[model samples]
Target: MTLEETAILGCALQWPDESLPFLTEAGIRADTFSHEIPSAIFTAIATAWLAKAPGGFVGIATALGDRLDALGGAATLQTAIEGAAQPVTLPHYAEIVKEGHSKRRLALALKAAYKQLTTEPTGTVLAAIEAEISSIAAGRDKARIQSTREIVMSVLGNLNSRTDGSKMAGLSTGIVRLDEETGGIRKGGYWVIAGPTKGGKSALVRYIVRAVALDQAKPVLVFGLEMSSDDTVEAMLATEGKVSASRMRDGTMHEMDFPKLQAAANNLALAPIFFRDDVYDLAGIRSYVRQVKAIQPDLAVVVVDYLQLTEGAGSADRREQEIAIVSKALRRMAKDENLAVIALAQLNDDGELRECRAIGMDATVQVTIEMCEDEPGARLLRLRQRQGKTGVVVPVVFNGETFEWHPLAHEPEPASGKSFNRKRK
Candidate 1:
């Protein structure tokens, strides 16, 4: 063994508080203690002695000494320890001391010592360890990636499946033509409903939640970041009862809507839908989705009212960066958990609202709903299916009184005007 190793072993052998001073007098530094072998190898030995010692330094040192002498003669060991106390200056020692043992510097020191003793290139040694870790990680990631792809494929395949030749689940809103064009919300596929401020995104989401959860009995989870749980519930009740959200909040339902309100409340209470208003962080949302899935293994759908409201691990340079991180995470969670995740996003500065052209989504299908006074009470839901197809626009009408989405009775012809006449002929 090298002189350094011998000294470390000696220190490790002598652990008692009384003996610690002798080690210091012998020139060993106490605070620089490390359990790393060869370099901090003595520290590990000292710790092991300390674990056995009851009172303090004295008992530990005694126990350690006993083990060392049994392995070799004390005189021979002393020879090995004689010149081992040469002082060596460590870079960033002050910073390391300030940061404590777990800092990166300490880790690097131990790693360097290990590399030197093993006579291996530092990069090669690190790569070997990393390769082992990466190998295990790759296996796990491969499984996850495959499973996610399968879930998305399954959902899409089911939606387009022709065995029954009927729509799987109709769009919750009254927009019939829109429903016919896009085939109702497909399972396992992500849907983005984005628009500008005051575009009634929240209202539109509430309508879908009520339709799917209450009316259709599909298990849905809504991550309501923009609104409180109570407010979400109230809005849902309003949509269900065919009453204005204001009336529901005020507890003043019209006599005509009383029966509908009662039924809606009953439906909501029994629905399998779960709402989580507390999930504001992106990581928290990911965790909650896992937890929800654990309970409802077959959870069909998840909805985030709007993506911009969600927070990530830390604030970024701009809102766009934050949204990008959140968007990627949400898409990952969707595929990982095998559930359809529908997230609402806001439009850019430009007034143009189209699904395929919508910015910020890395995965899943996107649909933009443009609300304008010219198209009063009507929402133009532009459908852009990225994985499959694109360029399909369907006009949908929102019934103010019923709080429902209905497809326009007549499908709007393309702006080209040629298609309309071609169809007529």
Candidate 2:
């Protein structure tokens, strides 16, 4: 009747009633009834027995009564049986009957019991438990093999998809020709918008963010490392309100602009766009991405103000090396999160102006905007789409006030004159 004897009996009688006589002949019953058993142990044994038994209520009740008598009196046995049954609900009992009590179930039961006993779910304790589960589930030995295969397949898929250039979302950049050529900017791409100093990189990113996040109502996260959160918000307001950046800074908005500004502010306040001014290194950025994914799993895009400003964990021989690392991370994050990451990158100085190029072969599209002094403050936007090629090219004017790109009209190419008048020799 002791706990140990009851456990032995439970295990021995677990299979069938056919085994019980053998167990009794082996002195199991004599040993079990020699000392008083814990009621809990007796209840567990009786439950296990009844679970496998085909007997009706009379047989089960008889066994239960005998076990209760061996484990002290009926009241003590009933109390323990009630306590044990409280933990195993009808659903849980059914599950145990179906799948049997696994180690995982036992652990879960222990955890639930601990939580019930403590009456608290602190972060540290919960995290430890979660970590244990994750670690067990990870199967570390297979990680390297699985990771290698995943990377290979991902790269291959990207390569195969790149042959047919990306489709762009309709941006309000007014550049009909550029939009026609490159589609808009495809989702799930690391779009590098690079230009020289004062070349309106930030403005361009702001334009895209507004066009995509506001106009399209797609959720976006803007990581503004260079600008403060307030400055970024002000820039967005300026773009949305069609006010000049200078006017916003100087607080010298025209009387007519007030209504537009008020409307922009109201819209912005309710926008599903999120902005973070934290100067995150690559690791920090990755962590932020994970947090964002947990909350807004359906995020449409992420916009990093510029790549060069962000820090990463590498001792690059040059700044480009660091930029490459950051670029790859952004691309990977975009693919993993299934969101478009439009990152602004700074171009290396080429004479007086820096021009944009696709950072790596991973990018889905690349766009370069050049400001021309010949036309007296006209801007030319050139696009290089990764997938398909469309023979469309034109000049686009950047409206800093509204942060809009307006396509400029161009004259048709002059017809070449032929020397038909030349005498044949």
Candidate 3:
């Protein structure tokens, strides 16, 4: 161990209370210690601090009486104390220890990255590097507590700037009626829309992204893990170009449809949407978002085509555990990044979502979309919002050619099973 590291550890052991704040604030984890004995000692001290018990070496030794000799006993403690620097400079010394530890970690990580570069694609290697750098930056910039008065003043400033009395504080989702009901999408919000097979989940998500990115001019990151990027682009083109998706897929588009398709393609080519279909892991998504955000700091939204497909780090054998982990990470990302997240989920007939119950638990707004039996081109969006109202169903009509959903032209009789079309007034 370096002289500075030894001194910091020694200070932490002898004057635990006096040095606790400095060590903690230095963002030093037990692994940061160079030697096994000091690492173990630091771990014990951290445990004592959390438990609000005596944090001195004697107290730590007593707590780990059985393992004291393994941690080098009194001799090790004496050596650390003898080498210790001034207690007043403990924080400064702790920072040096932390910097050394970080360099060691970075070296190890870079070694692995070098191996990955030979085996993995360039994008994959870059993403891994981005993730590592972001993790380090986050540790350095961890948020501190804020005063309630200061928080209130900041919130008031936000409220005062908005001319609309609308409570929504984020980008609009582009659906007029849905926006009215939910007050538009809100910052740091997790929203889930669940539906059955062929329930237009992808269609709905695309429209929202198109609105936020193309029309509203906000940057968007979309993860389309279920489908290939090429297919996603084609579907979007069909929806935006007013061309029949089947015709486009079959290469049966009419001569007249060529103009519309070209127009839509040109418009979308300049959109602020960033699309990816490869990543399926939560960590990769976080890394990719951070990499993109560096260039477009104004990124306002993230959309995942479906939730069940995403995987995480740990052994998630059970479906519920997997869901919980994925949902929690996504929720944290939304809050930390302060962007709206729209995750689509599949629903079983029993009213249970596939894979996890955490989808409903973590979502700020849970919405269900199903075909409107009485209306051929319309779907019902049943809103169950935890942040606002619940049990409200907004009728929406989808123009299959345009792939857009709009408010119902007129109110319909309750449970009336009459078929209808998308004729707007």
Over 4 Å off, model 1: 1-176, 249-252, 352-360, 410-425
lDDT of 2 by residue, 51-149 (tens): 333332343345556665655555543443333322113233323322322344437745764774575446545554555545434421112112355
Clashing pairs in 2: 1-32, 1-33, 1-37, 165-387, 165-388, 168-184, 168-185
lDDT of 3 by residue, 1-425 (tens): 67887787678777766776556545666667777777777766655654356766578878778788987777776677787767788767877887777777677768888998887778877776667666665654233333466699988876875545644566777887788778777878898988877778888989888888888888888899897767877888987887888888788889999999899998987677777788999988887676455335577899988888898876888877987898888888988877888999987755567778668778888777766656678777878787777767788887876677888866443224421111110
Give the residue spans of candidate 2 off by over 4 A.
1-176, 315-318, 351-360, 390-394, 411-425
Q: In candidate 3, how many Å is residue 417 off?
A: 9.4
Number of clashes recorded per candidate? 19, 7, 0
How do all models score by TM-score?
0.56, 0.55, 0.63
Model 1 TM-score relative to the real fold = 0.56
Q: Model 1 lDDT vs. the true structure?
A: 0.57
lDDT assessment of candidate 3? 0.75
lDDT by residue (1-425, candidate 1, tens digit) is 44344444443344334343233333333333343333233443333332233422343334446554444434544553453332222122322322342243335645655765577666655554454444333422123112355689977876676347655443443345545555666655677777777666777777777667666667788888888767777777776776876666576867877887788778777677777787789877877665455334567788997787788778777666667777777777777777777888776545433222323345456666666344567766666666544656666776664566766654543332322112211
lDDT (Cα atoms) of all candidates against the true structure? 0.57, 0.56, 0.75
lDDT winner among the candidates? 3
